[model samples]
Target: MYIPAAFRSDDPDLAWQLVEDIRFGCLISGGLGLMASHLPFMVERGDAVRLVGHVARANPQWKELEASPVLVNFLGPNTHISPSWYTTSPRAPTWNYVAVQVRGRVRVTEDRETLRRMVLDLSALMEPDGSPWEAAKLDIAYIDKLLPGIVGFAIEVDHVDVQLRLSQQNNADDQRKVRAALGAGSLRERQVAETMTRYLGRLPE
Candidate 1:
């Protein structure tokens, strides 16, 4: 979470967007020797924002949520930037990526209703539009039976760190070259390229 001044993203809205856009993230409990769980998260914004998710009840990580400070890490599009792609000489290979880190204390819930609601909301977030399968369609009895096996939790955010390392340190020419190289690569790379254009503004071709 070390962010240089050049790479630091101070925009809260953009950070929230990243968390929502990439809903899947790692929930880490530092109160438990840094134990971690991979989970899908939902952003609850209001007077106080919250990060919500669930884990298997048997997962020991849940015990740590209330006992210690927690962190949620979300990674967006990323790509390797080869030194060869830079217009500037002597530049070493590096990465172009978007990452968000949230730190806070957590609150866990065992209520069946809350768990059910969390599941339904998560399914809606994950499912593509017009998909036939839906959580609401599942039998309530079955859902209730299954709910006992899981635990739902929410993290009240203490702080957030957003890093957008999109070659902001590079000169425009080198950045443009990196963007062009990224544009020619995978979907993720193309996403990085697109972000560069959007955030850094249009440059001379």
Candidate 2:
């Protein structure tokens, strides 16, 4: 999260969009000697910004939240930029990517209704065209039986850090070369290239 001024993104809306686009993240807590859980998050924006997610009851990471704040890491498209791709010599190889880190206070909720809502909302987010499998379609008895196996939680965000290291420090020619190299590669590489082109406007119009 050590973002240089040139790489830092001060736009909260952009950060939120990144979080939503890449819903899966690592939730980390240090009170229990550094415990982390990879979970798919659902963001809520309103009077108080919150991240809602659930962890398996068997996973002890949620238990540590009681003693510590959590850091959620949302990593977007990334690629390795070779020095050879640059227009000039004497350039060091580096990485280009977009990432957002959210620091927040977490609260574990065990309420059955809340857990059910969280699950439904998460399903909606994951599904291609909204989930056809609504909780209302499921048997209440089955849902009740499954509720005890998981723990729902919400994190009230304290701060957010967004970084887009897309060769902003490079000159226009070098950046264009990097973008071309990346876009000519795999699908993921192409995505990183597109993001750089879109956000930094380094590519010619």
Candidate 3:
């Protein structure tokens, strides 16, 4: 998360949007010599913001939470920016991307109600339009049987680091060039280009 002044972002709304946009993140924890679990999370904002997710109880990472520290990192649209695309001569290649880190120690729980609500809430977040697996329609007996295998946790958001390196350091002409080049590239590149476009007029000249 070493972000330059040009790339650093502190907008809380943007950070939350990015986290929700890319719900999947790498939960990093230390003390067992560093462990990571890739999990889909639901962002909770109230008196305090927290990232909620779960993992199998057997996953050793869960057991280490109390003894270790934790943080979750989410990555958004990213693309490789070729040096050839830039008008600036003598420039090396670089990546244009968005990344966020939610830093806090996780409070792990195995309470049946909490776990149930977590599963339901996660389902709803992933499927906002509603689904056949909606919490109410789901079989309670089956859910109960399955709940024991997993543990839920909520990471209180103590700090957030948002990085938006969408070619902001370059001049306007070079930014346009990168955008146009990416616009014609793959879908992922197109997405990165779009994000860059959104920030164009808003960022300083």
Clashes of each: 0, 0, 0
Per-residue lDDT of model 2, residues 36-118, tens digit only: 88889999999889999999999988788878888999998999999999878898889999899999998999999999888
Q: What digit string (tens of lDDT, one per residue) describes model 3 on residues 1-205?
A: 7988888877888889888888999999996778999999998899999899999998988988867568888998998999999887999988999899988878999999999999887876677574555666788898889899999999988899988898889887998899999999999999998888875555444
Candidate 3 — which residues are off by over 4 angstroms?
Answer: 128-133, 199-205
lDDT scores for all predictions? 0.87, 0.87, 0.87
Candidate 2 regions exceeding 4 Å error are 130-136, 201-205
Instruction: Compute each candidate's TM-score over C-alphas.
Output: 0.92, 0.91, 0.92
Tell me each candidate's RMSD, in Å, in order. 2.7, 2.7, 1.8
- Candidate 1 — what's its lDDT? 0.87
**What TM-score does candidate 1 get on C-alpha atoms?**
0.92
Candidate 1, residue 114: Cα displacement in angstroms equals 0.8
lDDT, residue 126, candidate 3: 78
Model 1, span 1-205: residue lDDT tens? 8988788877788889889887889998877577988999999999988999999999998987899888889988888889999866887878988889999889999998899999888888889998999888888898888899999999999899988888888887888889998999999889999888776542121
Better of 1 and 2 by TM-score: 1
The residue ranges of model 1 lying beyond 4 angstroms of the native Cα positions read 201-205
